[model samples]
Target: MAWVYLFLGGVFEVGFTTCLRFTDGFRNIPWTIAFGICIVLSMVFLEVATRNSIPLGTGYAIWTGIGALGTVAIGMMFFGEAATFVRIFFVLGLVACIAGLKLTSGH
Candidate 1:
């Protein structure tokens, strides 16, 4: 269940990050509100997962991993960011690290 919470938090992390791009430095009220809500919700879920006996370091690494991976993809797909070969390679490396962290965590 903690894993569920953790993953949900990651999903929300991606959402908030995507919304952040649209916020225009908090001048866009709707996107800013969405970003604010998602940030709070993401933190709540992360805190819950940590409380469930997930190692703090492991949980935080995974959370930020998910955020990073998701943000890169969003940048490519939605924001016209270049998806160069080098970028793809690094993103895949990030995936490997995230997976390795999960497997080694002994959760």
Candidate 2:
């Protein structure tokens, strides 16, 4: 379904973002390629997701919410980035917003 595509898109968004960090301004060849491929695939999935019944606002909000949370978690786990309480709270808020959008959108 469209929601599945949206979720996969979000996962690929996280993958590309993490690859961006590893690419180091595109100096790393493998990471750069990985990042580019992931980005392209993510966009493809997002486009497909948009073609279904879900409203643009709801789909995009959910996609971005998942992507943001996944990116931060990956950063913290793999890059030694801070996982502060405020950041966690903000991620929770993003989840709440996604839920609210889904409920109001009836999808």
Candidate 3:
């Protein structure tokens, strides 16, 4: 359950970041509001997960890992960001590390 919360939080982290790119420096009211909502939800879920006995360090690492991975994928897919081989290599490495953390976390 805690892990589920953490995963949802991570997904919302991605939501907030992706919305941030569309915010137009907060001038775009709709996107800005969406960003705000996502960020709040992300924090709420993260706090819940952490308070449920997830190790602080492990939870934070996984949360940020999920955010980073999702954001990069969004950038490449929607924003025309480069998807070079080295870039993909590191992304896969990050995925592997996130999985490793989950597998070894003893949760």
Compare the candidates by lDDT and give the number of the best one: 3
Worst 10 residues of 2 by lDDT: 50-59
- Pull out the clashing pairs in model 3: none
* Colliding residue pairs in candidate 1: none
For candidate 1, write residues 1-107 as lDDT tens digits.
99888888998999899999899999999999999999999999899999967898999999998989999999999889999999999999999998998899897
Backbone clash count, each prediction separately: 0, 0, 0
> What ranges in model 2 sit over 4 Å off?
none
Between the candidate structures 1 and 3, which one is better when assessed by TM-score? 3
lDDT of 1: 0.92
Q: What is the lDDT of residue 71 in candidate 2?
A: 95
- Give each model's whole-structure lDDT: 0.92, 0.87, 0.94
lDDT of 2 by residue, 10-102 (tens): 999998988998898899999999999999988888889888778887788888888898998888888888889998888788889878887
Q: How do all models score by TM-score?
A: 0.95, 0.91, 0.96
Over 4 Å off in model 1, which ranges? none
Better of 2 and 3 by TM-score: 3
